[model samples]
Target: MSRFPLFAMAVLGLGLVFLYVPTLLVIATSFNESRLAGVWTGFSLRWYGELLNDRQFLNATANSLIVAGLSATAATALGTCAGLVLARHGRFRGRVLFLGLLATPLVLPEVIIGLSMLLVFVAAEQTLGWPAGRGIGTIVVAHATLAMTYIAYIVQARLTGLSRECEEAASDLGASPLRVLTAITLPMIAPAMGAGWLLAFVLSLDDLVIASFTSGPQSTTLPMVIFSAVRLGVSPKINALASVLVVMSAVCLGLAAWLQARRGGKVLPE
Candidate 1:
């Protein structure tokens, strides 16, 4: 019986290795001195240095960061408001329709979403003469649209699980609804909001399909640039860029985890 359990553990360990070994290989290959991505000649930081000097890469990075930051902020605000309405408003009319509309992007194919947004932008530019062209603004709007649904879902789940007694108590103590929301509710759900914001940021940063459709020629993102580079040939500089992004993603995730742990505190339930 113990032997069987040990065998199962071995299989599980092998599964983990299969999943993560490729990722580790990518990280290791990023330091290769050779221009070839797969063939490692020796460990070197030259690729990283070259990546820093690439103007196109730098421009793409700046564009990605700006879109991610702006879209995440807008999405978080919209999603939090939507989540609060869903959680607090009891049996409002058209709630089902509202929820379905909000969740459409989550279930819809990315290709469909990108195409639809692109068409809409084209239509608007032709008819209304507004947003005369597609660029960063278009990309930001597209990203924010996708991100809002995820944030709303996260926040709604968090709000549903949280205790309502605290809000009720605040209400009893002559606290206005807005006051209670700003002080008690927001503080308690801060962790969820932070998580949602980070998630939105990552989604926007990583998006290629939607950004490709929505962005103009001059506003190409990092992923688009990398994809173009990969089409030409695999370069160690690309790997180095990817390694930097991986580190950034890990740091963001770690920070979110820390915030969650701190908010929950060190106490264990008896």
Candidate 2:
């Protein structure tokens, strides 16, 4: 058993190094004086300054933030509703079909989802004269679709772990259905909702494949910009941008974890 634990720890350490070493290298090289990413002559913050001044990168970052914020919010709302209905209410007609459809985006290839959404946009624009054309709006919609699945999964898991007795007690105490849901159900599941939102935000921010198909010239997201830059070759500037994104994601995920832990401590019986 001691040997097994040692082996497991070694395996875990190896896994962490594999995942994080490349990122650490990128961050380190971003400060290297040499333009070539591999060779480091000396450290400098010039690339960071350049990135801050680059109008195109700035615009892409802003667009990404807007899309992520909107998409995550929308996905969280829709998913929370879907999860509550699925968990609290008994199985309704077409429940399995509805769930399958909702989760299809989660398992489906990004290329396929992007192509399908593009086709739908084209059809809608030509037939209904809605959407006008593909741009930021379409990208947000695509992101929301995928993000909703993640949110739904998280919320559903939390709901499964929750006791229905709390809601019953609230109702028994003369609380209306809406009041019980607002006061009991929503509060109980808020941590899951928060976790779902953060996941959605990261997913939207990191997305490139779907955004590529949906975005127009005016709405290039940060990931798209980084991808285009990387295709030219690895640059310190790209490394700097990637490092910034990684830090932001880590911070967001950490906050989500803290919130979840706090909620769990409060909710679980002593």
Candidate 3:
């Protein structure tokens, strides 16, 4: 401890406090006896019970889970394909343009993405007379689009650091392109794929802005419900919901760390 610089230690302490203090407060408030958030009369579990019984909340949670699960799967598939193509297919036509398009969503504002998606959906409805209206399907599509960018980047980074010897060896043995991908490339990047899928799931579950724009009356997600509750005022119910979300986020983070560590172990020479 004494070997560390004082300024660095102070900054680290401040940063930890900045990040976790509010989270700690929210968790604590969820157990409070009072109905209001941040006002603790005593300890209580009433809010958690109430949360379990709230029909709207439960519906929103179900919708969010469905969207997150389906969207994450879709994003992982699309992103993994994108990453594989970019990593393995050397110097294709419009490679730079394709990569740039893939990366655009990562840096683009959520508002812009949401608005553009909304317009596209509206146009499709008007022109094709399909989709009927925005709902779970639209939300899933929007989230998948947002999540795929992150997945593509992660898979790309993983592939970049990977040795291509296995793939080359397989090709030399007369394995077809599809066989090499399925048998060698995918197995090599399995950890990265798992990480990317979890990342996509978490991102989709936590989204508010894009869901707000793309979701319709039938498809209110958990974040939207939480946001509405906050506008009215923070209650113990909100605190409880937030606490559950925190637990979920922590689990996802732990799983990601485990996957990364496992990948590192496999990649390192013994």
Q: Model-by-model lDDT, in order?
A: 0.85, 0.87, 0.87
Judge candidate 2 at residue 189 and give its lDDT.
Answer: 91
| Per-residue accuracy of model 1 over 69-172 as CA lDDT, tens digit each | 99999999988988788777889889999989898878899899999999999999999996779999999999998988877776777787788999999999
User: What's the CA RMSD of model 1 in angstroms?
Assistant: 3.5
Point out where model 1 deviates above 4 Å. Answer: 1-8, 264-270
Regions of candidate 2 where Cα sits further than 4 Å from its true position: 1-9, 265-270
lDDT of 3 at 90: 92
Clashes of each: 0, 0, 0
lDDT of 3: 0.87
TM-score of each: 0.90, 0.92, 0.93
Question: Residues 20-64, candidate 3, lDDT per residue (tens digit)?
Answer: 999999989899988765456998898899999999999999999
**Cα shift from native, residue 220, model 3 (Å):** 0.3
Give Cα distance to truth, residue 232, candidate 2, Å.
0.6
